[model samples]
Target: MARNKFQTLTEQMFYILLALQSPCCGVDCMERVRQMTQGRITLGPGTLYTLLASFEEAGLIAQTALEGRRRIYAMTPAGREMLQGEYARLKAMTADYAAYYREEEKQ
Candidate 1:
């Protein structure tokens, strides 16, 4: 059986994809991730740029230069597909955990 490409995504990759779900520049992307995680998972500038570069290399995202020093990023078709897969996986995991907890409560 062929392995799924999305299985290679680490937590950082998932967060990066989630951040790019909205079209945003680098600074905005970082801030969005921070806000979304309620400041619990703030990414450093170096890590953010590295992840962006990797995403761009994988063709999951594309970068466009904005005015002056801004590079805006948006998800590609591949990125959207990856995000969808991740969402499904997370949904299933959450549902399974919920069921397990419910059963435990009944005990």
Candidate 2:
């Protein structure tokens, strides 16, 4: 089977999708991402808009509405599934790290 290009998402992509759990415009999405990460992740307009365009192109997100020039976006069903898969992957990685360290501690 061919691997999905987006099988793994960059941290920016992950958070951008996460912020779109509800419909929001580009600026709002950027703010939400920063707030969600407690300012740990700050996305500039260039990066955020670029990823949004890419996500929309990939069918991972949809533009739900437009307020003037701003476009409100929401995650599509495909986007949610992709996000869940990424979450599982992250969990598995953490589990592997823990398992490895646990055996080391036992030795």
Candidate 3:
């Protein structure tokens, strides 16, 4: 099924935040996300930039420095909080789904 756009705890956002948990340049962040997902989610430049922009605008992320042509990013407290909230929400959703499926299988 297609993913819902309203879902704030998205894989992309999660991975981005995860990548930023440590200092990372834009390209490194994208690579880290790709590696973490085992190539399942490859973020394009446009999408990555857009997400970064949104995160910065939301005060969740910040660009820390520039190494040559690369822009490094880091997670702020707000970003960490957001990530934690998303993780909790996802965990709850997974548990709910698991319980529902288990019951369904019993029938």
Candidate 4:
């Protein structure tokens, strides 16, 4: 059986979509991710471009502008819902882990 495409987003995909919350070109995406992650996440041009194409194809993101060779992307309604769902899932995971550790401490 095939897995769902949007089951989860990679770190790169998450940050890319996040950067797209505002209008920004490809180069701006790299900078934004760097600032947001404090240089922990480095986005290479190849990965960024590939993910952009895939996201656009999947209707997760739409091109809002084109400046020279750069394309500015933003989240679509679908993309926003996807992000929210992913955030919820992540939160649940952390909550569960924290609960387990708290229980362990009481023993």
For each candidate, the alpha-carbon lDDT, in order, equals 0.81, 0.91, 0.85, 0.87
The CA-based lDDT of model 3 is what?
0.85
Task: TM-score winner between 1 and 3, please give it.
Answer: 3
- Candidate 4 achieves a global lDDT of 0.87
- Write the residue-wise lDDT of candidate 2 on 14-90 in tens digits: 99999999999999998999899999999999998889888998989999999999999999999999999999999
lDDT of 4 by residue, 1-107 (tens): 01167679888888888888888888988999999999999999999999888888888889998888877898888888888888888999999999999999999
lDDT of 2 at 96: 100
Which stretches in model 3 have alpha-carbon errors above 4 Å? 1-7, 105-107
Tell me the lDDT of model 1 at 6: 52
Model 1, span 42-61: residue lDDT tens: 88889989888878877888
Error of 4 at 5 (Å): 1.4
What ranges in model 2 sit over 4 Å off? 1-3
Q: Which runs of model 4 end up more than 4 angstroms from their true locations? A: 1-3
Please give the RMSD of candidate 1 to the true structure. Answer: 2.8
Residue pairs whose backbone atoms clash in candidate 1: none
lDDT of 1: 0.81
Give candidates' CA RMSD values in order: 2.8, 1.8, 4.6, 2.1
Highest-scoring model, TM-score? 2
lDDT of 2 at 15: 96
How does model 3 score by TM-score? 0.86
The candidates, ranked best first by lDDT, are 2, 4, 3, 1
User: Residue 54: error of model 2 in Å?
Assistant: 0.5
